[model samples]
Target chain A: MMKRIGTYLLQSKYAISVTVLIFVVLGASLATSSFLTGDNLITVLRQTSVLFILSSGLTAVVLTGGIDLSINNSAALVGCIVAQLLLLGVSIPVVILAGILVGVVIGIFNGLLVGILKLPPFVATYGTNMVVLGISTIVMQGKVIYDLPRNFTPIGVGYVGILPIPVIIAIVLTGVLYFVLQKTTLGRNIYMLGSNAYAAKYSASRSVLDTVVAYVICGVTAAIGGIVLTARLNAADANMGNSYGLQIVAAVVMGGTSLLGGEGGIFGTVIGALVLTIIMNVINVIGVSSYLQSMAVGIVIILMVWLDIFTRSKREKLSRV
Target chain B: MTTKSLGKRIGSLPPAVWMIAVMLVFYGANTKNYFTASNFISILIQAAPLFVVACGQTIIVLMQGTDLSLGASLNMMTVVWVVLMQKSLPLSVALPLAMGTSVLAGYLNGLIVAKMKLPPFIATLGMQNILNSVALVASNGSSVYHEHAIYKIIAKSSFLGVPYILWITIGCFFLTMVLLKFTRFGARVISMGGNPESLKVAGYSPDLATIQAFTYTGFMTAVAGFLLACRVESGNPIVGNGFEFNSVAAVLLGGTSMREGRGGVGGTVFGVLLIQILKNGLVMMNVSSIYQTAIIGIVVLFAIMLDAYIKRRQEE
Candidate 1:
């Protein structure tokens, strides 16, 4: 029974991340007086909520054997547009829809480049990211748009039964995505397509536009995350999304989602997001200079990836034996 | 091949050349001082650092690998050079110390990609961030100003009516060309990208080529980074921000096959020229930096799409 359990753990992509998250929480709670506090934990959860939402869409893209380096910028652009509309006295509902519509358009543009046109995901998205950043700069005149509407506050910070709205939104989004990926035809198609593109093309169960659909979903999710982030900050700026570029990619990667695609899922991403937040928090509690945070994050990603690699090779050896 | 087919092939070269041609004409006609020799010199000098890095990046891409960390490593070298000088170190001591770190980074990147059995994309990216952090930590996360008269003199010196930096860039270009065109290691590098299996059949490990390519990139990035630091006379943490992307874009525009490794570093010179010229022209035309980058991004994207479409048609 122990051997079977061990084998299962070795085979599961998410097992390591979950184990890491739990151990971190246990260690931090024991060592740091501030770590176990309700306020700190809630703050961690809020950060995870925003990160997880962004990473979920990225997970979908990576699953299709592609990446969207522009997702952060797209989210930023959406936030900028939403902020402008809010300032213009537009209703909250319309503002939200408008943000999503902008996301959808960006998604379609990216979809054409990567899917139909067959450009490289990173190159296409990187270029698109630059364009998105430029447009946002022009949209906001490179200034922060503060003073968000009061009604939007509940979405970012207000609580329902002592749980933050962003957290609730994240949980609901994760559950829906988990169901869709596990139970839907589109989800299976994505998996097959990612695993072997040519084989998928010949398979009778294939849809020609599976790649496009994956990107579109990614776009929509990015918009949702952007709206929440804007509400959370109560402002928008051109460079706000710039920092998330590395973090989001790192989170999605840590979540056990392979960059090469066809393996891993939403659940792994949740753990990935939580673990990232805790690591950043630990850096703060330990009083690493705030300026060195970027370096610290870089080290965390390298170590995490190396650990993953080390474990993977060990798993292969055990299977071989 | 006959002259007719040679002319035909030239005519059918990728869309980037045509686009650059149109851009040159339009900007030349519209912008004041766009066609002057002084502007040309300024653009070439501006392209110098990027051109040098792109030459090294050419080999990396030719081997079907990417070094997302080059820019960061370059950034690290700049700050390290300055910090060492600030500590009263002489030129000989400061130069090697700074250059060695990035070379080491390149070596680590090679090991991660070739030996650790990890993908180059993530490994290099992780390394890039680490190097970026190191630069920040070394210089306290801001610009470091130092009075390095040697670099300033080197920057100001003109040999044969051209600045020393331009000479260095030109030297690196020819060096890269000769290395790619004449060396056995170069053959192995190209083969590693074109077909790793064939390399093994020829009794050369593709892994060694990968390592060698990365090390080369490290050395060139150090040279370029330090030169740029001298030109600007300060160690800015983010000075090397866009070189990685710009170098890759230059490589692509040069018509090097990213997948097949079918081109040479010789073409990358023109690609670098195109980019620097475009930026200069836009600056002269009063375009803001942000929008200028956007336009360049769009043009690059369009060229890539057109190239892909043409390649697909050829394959079909």
Candidate 2:
């Protein structure tokens, strides 16, 4: 019974979160005297907000055993488009809407190729990412765009009392996404599809295209993330989100979302994002070179994946024997 | 009977024929200069490195694995080769050392996946990060802009009016093709991918096959890097930032299945030809490079879908 309990604990993604939280506490407490201060914690939250937002969508796609590599490039493309529009004197709301719409189009293209046409998600997204990045580069001509209107900046960098706007956005978005993923018929269908596509197809309760739409929704969330990032920086660059692709994936995996699909929760992803943010902040506090961060992050990712795999195999073995 | 045999001939041409036809048509229509002897030669020379790498990548993808570290490995190998040669090491020594580093890197990736049981995607992704840093550290973020005479001439000189690199690329392709078709190792690779469990039961480890595929891909990627070093007469840190995608796109376009156990070197050759021609044709036609890249994505999607459909039909 003790062994079984231990197995259950190991298999639970919550176990990893507890571990990360413990590390976060230790790192925050030790790295800087003010790391536990409300302001510093909020700053970490703010920094993690965009990744949290983006990974929310990616979590869904990954649940269906698919991935969207286009998000980072999509973010770049949307950032470029919005920057161009903002430069041309577009309203904040219009730019935001257009940014999301652009994501939808790219997502649909990815969906049609992967869902309807049966292309591998990796290849389809890879091609789309390159295409999008290329377009973004052309749009920006390798230039950065600043001069955002006042109202738009608040969405990313502003505060309501003690909380950053992006943190609030992250919370609200997480709640809404959690509801959609855990409660709705559509959400249930997505889980079904990811668990077993052929089974879902035969159940008379799910559609592959609808699941594909879910993947598109993931794309849209990533777009929102780009808009927020642009607002935070008060400028949009052509390669703004170039490094976020792997980072977001790492965040999702650490959150215990299976890349094979059909498992995990948004809440876990939020915590995962927090862990990543704290790690980055702590690294900064420790005065490590920026280049070394990637290597460190890579090692952490491998370790997390191993733990995930180990816990999963342990559970599978238990269930069988 | 002849009609059925004729139909079989058409069927046997592979779905990649459409991609080949599209490239040829575009190459012809885009410019009066496109199909001329001199330009064709130039295009082939331009495509040599990509083709070599694509051939390697195709083999791995055929095994249902990917090497994200290919680009970083290429960059590292080029830097290592140049920096080593500057220390007065002979070409023979520098070349082997570089190739050895790449193999070790690839072997490390294979070990991580096969021995450690990490997902190929994640493992290769990790390797890419590590190698990127290693490359930076090796050269202290410096560019090697000068090299020996032979290195420069390898990219510039031609035998029989073809760049020496082109000949080397062709040789690699021929060697790869022969190995894939005629070797025990190749047969084992296909069998392992076809059904890993059955292969395991038959006393062959899928891990071994996977390692072999990765090692080949690594070595060939280094070869591609060496050619690029020759072409530029210098090794820039940023030279191989996105070649992985180009190789992958070429392989996917050539008629390789993303799933394991199918595809061949011939398909990859055609795929590389198609990609190179498309890029060249777009340049000739004055299309924006962005739109050109977008078109390649669209074309690759169309080709993959067609391949999948035909494959499904065949299975039925």
Candidate 3:
């Protein structure tokens, strides 16, 4: 019975993530001793909250076989906007509303390019990333604004009865996204579009035009991630989210979403995010050099993709035999 | 019948016409000095290295593959060349050595993608990381400075009121154009890109074609690195960052299909100019460098979308 349960667990994609997470927790708990304490655990959750939110949005876009490389830049720009407006004494709610709106606008722009114009996703986002970076730089004049109000800070750091507000928000967002991805008509359309757009159009009455909305959601989520990041840092810098674009894509893909699209889920992505966070924390704990860390991340990425490919082809060979 | 053929030819111009027209308008509006001999020459000189790099990138993209490692490869060449020159080797020797390393890098990228059957994106991205690390290590993470006379002549010194780099860029363009248009190898490349499986069935090897494309990209990256080294009169390990994007942007903007099979060095020429001019114009107009990045990004998006629209209309 134990062996059968083990086989079932090991056969799942979530297994790899679970194993990695366990290794991290065990390592952290052993080394720091303070690591498994409630406060430290809460700190890890809070740190991971922003990445989770961003990855959720990116998950939707990748589902449609598209990527949003401009998210980091978009986040930077939105964060700068949020900071500038708050400095102008704009209310917290209004700042939040404006931030979400800016993300949607960027999303709409991405949608127009990919959906209507049919430009390749990689190229379209590459261009928008530069634009967003430039805009953010202009807004902040290459400075970080640090004078945010107390209410703003709580969205990232505040807790209610041992659970952080950001974590709570992340949980709610995940549930909502899970529903949208699994149960909604729009969600199914996205899967159809990513898997086979032509077939979807002919069979499911899916419009390529409307499928663009998914990318917008991806953009907005990235913006929200930016807001959370700004709150955590208590400032908005021009290049703040720069490292995220590649990392989030790595996390999503590692979580089992195909770069070719139409596979994977948020549950896997959450684990992926947690695993990534743990790997990063482990790297820090182990005191790996920053330069070497890039090489390590690159290696891990290649290995994950290689394993997926090998397993896929092995299965294909087995079926053929 | 002749008019119909002419109409078709006009329709096929795609994004190049708009890029050129926009460049001219932007230049004219932004500066009274736009058409002056000095300014024209300056723009060409500034665009020289990018144009040479994009020439290589154009060939690879024509084969329906991309070389994201171009910038990283260029950085490697720059560092190597700088170090070799520093070791008292003549500029001539160091330059050839740098070019050779680029070819090797390109060859490896081609091998991984063609032989190992790795996706071009993953292969090139891996090559980018490896080369980026090698470049940092080669220079020990510092810029290498030298003052060789020949190097100065090649990178910075001008002849007849034009930079030597401009001449090199033009020379490379003409060579690529001739090779692509007149050589059997070039014909084979276009055919392979058009349909690799069909080409294979017809007794051509797609692997060989892919390798050739990558090798060409490597060689051009070296040429670009040489120009950059001379222009700055030094080689900084990190100097080549964003070069791949610039090259890709130019190639795509110039009407080269990302899917390969349909691109030319000629269109890439105009595309390179358009990118360089847009950047220079932004600087000239006193737009902050930060905002300029955003503006360029937006313009590139517009350029690609415009290209897509033109292609769609042509199909209809």
DockQ each candidate and list the results: 0.61, 0.52, 0.47
Clashing pairs in 2: A63-A262
After superposition, candidate 3 runs with Cα above 4 Å error:
A1-11, A16-44, A197-205, B1-7, B75-105, B115-118, B122-151, B158-162, B182-185
Over the stretch A203-248, how does candidate 3's per-residue lDDT look in tens digits?
Answer: 4324455456888888888888888888888898998986575567
| lDDT tens readout by residue for model 2, A180-281 | 889997777777667775472564323557657877888898888888888888898878876686778788888888776777878878888888878888
| Error in Å for residue B211 of model 1 | 1.3
> What's the fnat for candidate 2, on a 0 to 1 scale?
0.50
Q: What is the TM-score of chain B alone in each candidate?
A: 0.95, 0.89, 0.92
Error of 3 at B128 (Å): 4.2
Stretch of 10 with least lDDT, candidate 3 chain A: A200-209
* Tens digit per residue, CA lDDT, model 3, B206-287: 8887888888788888889988888877878778877887888888878788765888898898788888888888777777
- For candidate 1, give the DockQ: 0.61
In model 2, the Cα lDDT at residue B185 comes to: 74
User: What are the runs in model 2 whose C-alpha is more than 4 Å off?
Assistant: A1-5, A31-34, A37-39, A197-205, B1-4, B85-92, B139-143, B313-316
Best by TM-score: 1
Candidate numbers, best DockQ first, in rank order: 1, 2, 3
- Between candidates 2 and 3, which one is better according to DockQ? 2
lDDT of 1 by residue, A36-58 (tens): 89999999999999988887888
Error of 2 at B120 (Å): 2.2
